[model samples]
Target: MARPSYLARRAGGRYFLQIRLGKRAAELFQLPLLRVSLRTSDFAEARRRLVDNLGWVLELIEAPDLEAIGTVFDVRLRAYVDRGSPADERLLAERCAFENEVRRYFTRAQERGYAYQKRFPEIPGRWVDFVDQNKAAESSITRLTARRSYEAGRREAREAFNEGWEPAPNKAPALRPETLDPIAMLDRLVQDAVGRRMAQLAPGNLAPVAAPTIVPAETGNPNEPAKSDGSTATTPDRMSILLQEFLRPAGRKRQHTMKGRGEAEAVVQFAIDFLGDPRIDELTEEKWKLLDDALPDIPNRDNIPREFSQTLFQRFKYAETHGWKDLVRVTTTTIQSRYWGGLYKFLDFVIEQKLYAGPRPKFVCIDPENLAPLPRDAFDDTELLQLLQQPLFTGCKNRLHVWQPGGYFVQSHIYWGFLICILTGMRPGEVGQLKCADIRTDGEFYYFDLRPFDARSGRVALKDLRNLKTNAAGRVIPIHPILIELGLLDRMQDLIDKKEERLFPEWEAYIRKDGTVRWSQPLSKSWQYVKKLLKLSRADLTLYSTRHLMADWLDNEAIAQRTRDRILGHANDVRGRYGRKGILDPEIAAKIEALEPAVIKQMRKMLLSAKNRADAGGLTVLKTY
Candidate 1:
């Protein structure tokens, strides 16, 4: 879609609504052009804002006098109109003050024209020419608009005086400098009118002025219960406060891990920063609309949640001041999935608690084109050949120097990790964090046990209780015959005999700064190095290609989808829910033994021989591939 000509983009990508004023309007405005910051780089957001404010802009351009322009941006115009009783003292005082200001402007205009006439008696078309020729000329809009106001006020003042509502002769307001600038004068009048409205609508008198249709987010500290004695309590209605209540583990509706809770908190903070700490009661559909509009403008800069030292509002200001050339804004999908999705749950929690009575915000609906999941391809025969030919698979110097070619036929985690994933379709992390006890048997066949660990995975102390990705991830898979033939059982027996807990003791539990533990990072890093060496690295192929390869083999073998899903630890149908222990099935075991990929078959002979030689205390030294 072509960008609108009225919306001009800056070098840094922020949009500005630039409208050229007409000659009469320009005379009123004292400038030929008007520009406003849309406060966004996103084209869609700018377009949405244009649709909302464009009419007001056009109306300002066509406005004959100051009255219309003064209230152009008055979002609370209705509130101002409804403020105070008809005979209110504040209203009468405001009218008296307004009349005095108008008479003062009229006198100032007459004095300026008379002064110009006295100075240039012989030469002039009119006092306007004198004023226009001066370096700092008064806008004709202000003079004409002020004169119109004075004429109107004179009639109103005469009626008020006859009705005995006269201003005190001793209490005239102090003199102020003349405001001849059109926009400045409009701002001043709007401010005075709003002040009177606010005073009349202050707490103890009436409810505060209504907000723009904009929704407000929860922020600040949680609200405390009022005293039982029934004294008034200051309500802690900020979004930050409410978000804490929702995230509190004991009272929370849904339990999340530390990382998950952190992510949710970040989302709430984002809403708070963007929409501000409006009380829960202050939220409206329009505030939510504002949030929706601003979501796309959020830059997709790296290290968010970690490096976000400033609020979203501050970031927008920074971008507007500086430039967004180095940043890439988030997509609508990101907005819908992460930003809006997280907030949806929060709003739901608020409603559930009865803290807010507003309608819930709907999720951001978006088209599904270009939103396909990333493709992970199975490793082909040639790629497998290249991988098996690497020194880590064939022969390496030592465990630490796996890249260097030597006589060391060490069958460690590095050697067995990829093979296990390919044969059993177990996740790399599950394989990496395997315990010797996790490899179990039911008299006839052995299988791998996969479940969350309480405190330890092997001898390593976990940062927290290690968790599976989903409930279905906790399952058992029948061990392939290739693994048994390749001495996986012997490796487990060896670890048990040595009093080792973990199957792969070399892989230490890695704790991140956020206190999350990772088991597969070391093996994944090694895979990358090996892939780089063999020139087999690509977006579609990784350690996960092994799982995809196994899935493909199972599909070719005519395995039922449910059986395949069960074997691969995917969420299952009715039967999966009944099995509490997840022991190996005989039919599943037979199916697992029935299938064999050509890539594994080609490398099987060499791998088995290497394992046998390593078991017999011998070495297969290799100087070259």
Candidate 2:
């Protein structure tokens, strides 16, 4: 058999391996190249040892983060020192003896000054070389301390030599304060190795502890529930970790988009803050009740006093004592639906994943009477009049500040998103996520082919895989005549010409820290700013009001219920039955054209007026951020 390219024979007829590190691995190990002695002259034995060494190198390179890299190093160190044997004390003794010999060179009177310091400028390098020559594995931390110990040992040895002291070879030397403590370094590594071994054997030996335990004082809330004996019964699995597990494809049946995952995490994080991240097994009925009671205390999403409180628990406490009548609190509907609903899903996930071995914990019962979903307050005609005349729709000073008035008639996602929502009754999320490909022409009329880009469906490209809230959310809706007249079709053609993917390319996707991606964040933020400018004080009045307005218009027009449901993406329709082809496009377009003609005319009149004013002031189109 031939020797591998990485293998080489030393003068002593022993084989050694030399492997160059990748950039990440080099940075992590603080080494440019690694050389390991196979310690065998036979080519076959050297090849066998190469596999294990290469595997370790690969593990170091593949580690995700610093902590993970540290874990790999720790495992390597443990493997060297303990070897998974019952003779850990003996192993430590061997390490102690080796460290003692290493100290002798620095402690000798002849080797204490510039001559020795110049020879080994970096003690860690010398230590690494020493370990490599001896074919012993050592950790990076131990190597680092070696240099520190060398300098300390040299200082003390010089002082002791001045006092006419001579070192004895038979015994371990006593460490003075100025000396580097090699024993302490060895003790730490030994403890870590032994502790990990004990932990590996601990789980099977542990008996189940009692319930109704006192919550730890550091948790701040004394009433918070814990396990029996004032100690936790379960392992330390953080709520964030389990929540991420559930949000991923493997833990739950459904896989959510990045935005959906973020929303789920936010809700679960609230529970964690309230419950002190209690283990799944420790979540009792009383703990559940505490969360339920705190639900009412949670400030409304829009009304949270972020300046005063940080955590959900702190905000809840602040809401309890503050009796300002104007202080908006979360309603019964919000508590029953969002808060309780989120926790229920998480609890179900835990049980399904077998994270909790005991019977499922009972949640507080929400009264059927109070469980009704609240409809968002729709914008009235007056509110619409004020909102439509804003700088974004009419004209703005520049794209950077859409709220400021000027001659620049900027038309970006923020301008078109509101129009799309109001005219077509599409959700803000749906409108914001539209691609240029979603636009289609039927005969003489243009319409939105509103359907999710499912990779399985093969109807749309995988690259166009945007999220839909529900199966019913897949449907076609005709573009309103006002939008066609206002250059929407022209804009679509322009985007196609430019080969831009999204209809609104300026609106970038927002990614949360946990890696959930969301569109419409900027649109939503701009909408809030517009609302503030328009003096719309009601918290419930939002962009969704456009959908409500469209629904009311359709109802007042006496459009068919089925048609209205299809247009609004109501859950009445079967999942995949609608929006395949433009079968109902003509009928829907004709009906939309006929319904609210007066309102459409008024909107056209407002647009024309705004245009004339902007044109008189030298109208120019500018790009948005």
Candidate 3:
């Protein structure tokens, strides 16, 4: 019934322990009032907790140095930095494990009714706060138990008096005296533990430790400190480190494509080589402009102006003399989109991590005049015929062999894979990553199941999984009669017999450093060989041109725009969105089959020629299509 002391109930119906700080401590710690929640609804319990809370406040005030009160949070942060040190790998790993344990322990304590944020209002909630709150709660509970017993005893005595009987002497329970300040006791425990850890982690140095130096890019010069505003700045986060962190699974929900990652790495490497591998904070607008200026000189494989081409050829010759090989050229769009986009993304991460103090830079835009014209994507019928007649597509001992023809039919998968792409509007990757199981039969129709699967059976890595470019890419495409006649089902059966999960097991998966598997690498290489042998002059007639060719074919056949888009894994329109996505309708399948007769006749001619050669060599003849 008495007015609460410094412990008062707020509008939330919970009690708070309010204490006004002195001028010196307030300025040092940057707070005026230390208003911590007692974390109780009962007034009596609040009063009891207030005693312990006030003790901690007094201890803080009396301390010689505010920084001396190092918490487990500081220790954990220090340990994280140490773990990145090349010199103390073993010790740092141990410290990291210990830090994790401490974090988990405090998390459990929080779950067990310990109020962290409420108790330490000024300081960020950490393991040390959890420990203190837990200890204080235990002490309060003990006092509560004693207080309840004493009250019960007083009630019994009142009952005895009402019954007109004299109460027994010394029978009443006595409330225990407050022997120790709970907060002070916990503070001692936390400080002692933290002090021991700090000494172990960094012997003799009681001062706060700085964060560890981030691992720089491959081309990064570690000795060079980041320059900021014409002055040497503190070692900023490395660009490579920033990019790696940006690509981490937790950083973003969507995974980056291999091409995207390659572009990012290329830009980062260029930036480091050109700009001396400075910290992310050092990636100023001026530095970016330098990169932009250099982009034009970086020779691109794509078409360029005659002057630029001559300059590139001369540079190539000069580089050949110096033994430097495979120099990549960046286009204006590559600079504006891939390079600038990568830098922009990295900058975003820097800003998000609060490492960059500079204002956000605008995205690099290419001038309409500076942008190079893109080449045609679709291959002409003559080019497509040339592609079909290649040695790899006909029959070969090894698909990789430039000219050897007299061997077992080892290139059937590669041959059919390309043929399938030309007939159906499928991506190269989609065909390359197809498993035996993906060649499914539904009733009278057979189709390729271009859908993702759980590839976590240790047989294949995540990167090896059939990753689609987009949601619409996961579709069922009915097998064209040309593919079926080319023994596509028989090929799947052969793979199944060999216990191979992938239909194109011969086309080995190339797992990238980042754990992304690229099944299309071998296929891409073969296509390059095919293009070179056939003397294809059009840069746009790359392996992806198969899909473009199909687009052209379907368009020529006067197929619906939605149907064409659906077949080629393009985004669907409003009407197309109404039905089940990625599932081919029976009517649509019939229409897809309509374009197969011409393709079948062409494949039949090529197979017949290969069969005749095999028969002449006394080799087993391939089945007639």
Candidate 4:
């Protein structure tokens, strides 16, 4: 029984390692398809290597004796050899292909029960190895085929092949092209596209694509958006506050956000270095100078926009107006410099994020200490009567004639927005974002629903309203007469009747050129105009001051601490849901409305008649420590 083995054979004609097998090779016969001339290689090493190695091969194959033995001894080997075949490449290859052909021939031989084993040969090695290895292997088939002299005729074919030889060509070269500039080619393509598409549109082709125009790339397509190509572009004008502010969208992947941060920081760092604060001033000086110095040379891309800077300044002025001046007073040696520095950084952040423009804010704070030097005869009682005679604001366009009758358009409407702010104490953002639908007048109360607003660019660019400044900032405040007189009730009713969502329009203006709009002006202009007309100047008073005024007004009148806090968007200790929206209960409206108009009107009349109440001898708290 031959052992299992590795087998290889020629498909055409050749002698090759056919089956490597051993003494225990009977497993070959188990395979029904395996039928062969079970003969050995004429080469001695072929028998020893292949046959001797079958033990190792048997460990791998799961088949039992018959399949293994038949495959190794007969299905693979072809042992017919014409006497004197030489070993050569032509001989080896032809035989390699031929041996397998001969192996296949044996399947026919077995069925015929022929006394002969035949070989159709291509090269010499097959017949030679059959003679040599078989003699050494003494395989069972060799013993059988020997008595049959008819097989020797089949082995003579290989002797004809090695006698004729030829060589194959190995090397050849083809012509090729010279230059390849992939980037330059892409650039040219983009340029061609831009030139072709950028001509004036035919008609009705007016929609801003999500994409901004593509500028030619420095190397290729300038219009392509910035890629993380380790590149930089510089510009002289630094007005794009958002570019400077360089804020990335919140909650982006670290890799993406880091890239945005890098771009933002590049622009912002330039601005900061330009400010040169630390270098110009001594350490003792407000030391705003220290920021430029201390900031690491490398920073994430965070734009420090001008708008944010202006807001910080505005915030400071607001604080000063509200008796928080202790936070803003800047001085060379003021230990409070830290707060100012923070203010600067915060403003820088705001600018980069497009919160404000780059220019520092210029809004002034009113002095609580001085209100004197009034222009005499500015308005007599007779004038006051006429000013009062004008019925309070009605829902009129008034855009054409807001200054009608006495050019006191601002004065006429001052009481509208101003009084409400004083009564409600909502910040400007809250007030500006207001809408008519938000005001609620039900059974026995007035509720101002503070919702989202976006007056930037008059909502032409985009609608930018949101629910509240913060969850805590959202509140419903009970209204007083001022709210009613200001047309809030009518507006709310109009909205409800019409089923509209908006509460107010933060006013703006537009210009039409040739019956087509081209430009717009901020509507806050109208607000300012209204303030000027009233001649009622107060410290830190703006739309926001109303919220302050309301809080202080309530406080001065001895309103409960919990209630005052609730009115000012602060949490009320008496209630778990602190701040403005918590004050939404109808009960709060009843309480706010309960304030005597007589007291309010009296305070107003008295304050207006004089500059400093010291002349009227308003009491001052004397400190005698």
A best-first ranking of the candidates according to their lDDT comes to: 2, 1, 3, 4
- Scanning candidate 1 in windows of ten residues, the lowest lDDT window is 454-463
What are the runs in model 4 whose C-alpha is more than 4 Å off? Answer: 1-245, 248-271, 275-398, 406-415, 451-467, 485-487, 497-499, 506-527, 530-543, 571-588, 597-625
lDDT per model vs. reference: 0.65, 0.66, 0.61, 0.41
Candidate 4, overall lDDT?
0.41
Ranking by TM-score: 2, 3, 1, 4
lDDT of 3 by residue, 475-525 (tens): 677788767765677777876887878777666678765556566776688
Error of 2 at 614 (Å): 6.7
- The residue pairs that clash in candidate 3, if any, are 299-329, 300-329, 463-517
Q: Residue 158 of candidate 1: its Cα lDDT?
A: 94
Worst 10 residues of 4 by lDDT: 454-463
Assess every candidate by TM-score: 0.52, 0.56, 0.53, 0.35
Query: Which regions in candidate 1 have their CA more than 4 angstroms from the true location?
Result: 1-237, 241-259, 277-281, 297-337, 348-355, 365-372, 451-466, 510-518, 528-537, 575-584, 612-625
Candidate 1 residues 210-320, lDDT tens each?
Answer: 333322223222333334343323456778679777666543334444444444566677777666566888888989877776665666544433334255555555555
Better structure of 2 and 4 per TM-score = 2
Which of candidates 2 and 3 reaches a greater TM-score?
A: 2
- Candidate 4 per-residue lDDT, tens place, 134-184, comes to 334334434545745555644454554567733467678775547888998
Q: How many steric clashes between backbone atoms does each model show?
A: 14, 1, 3, 95
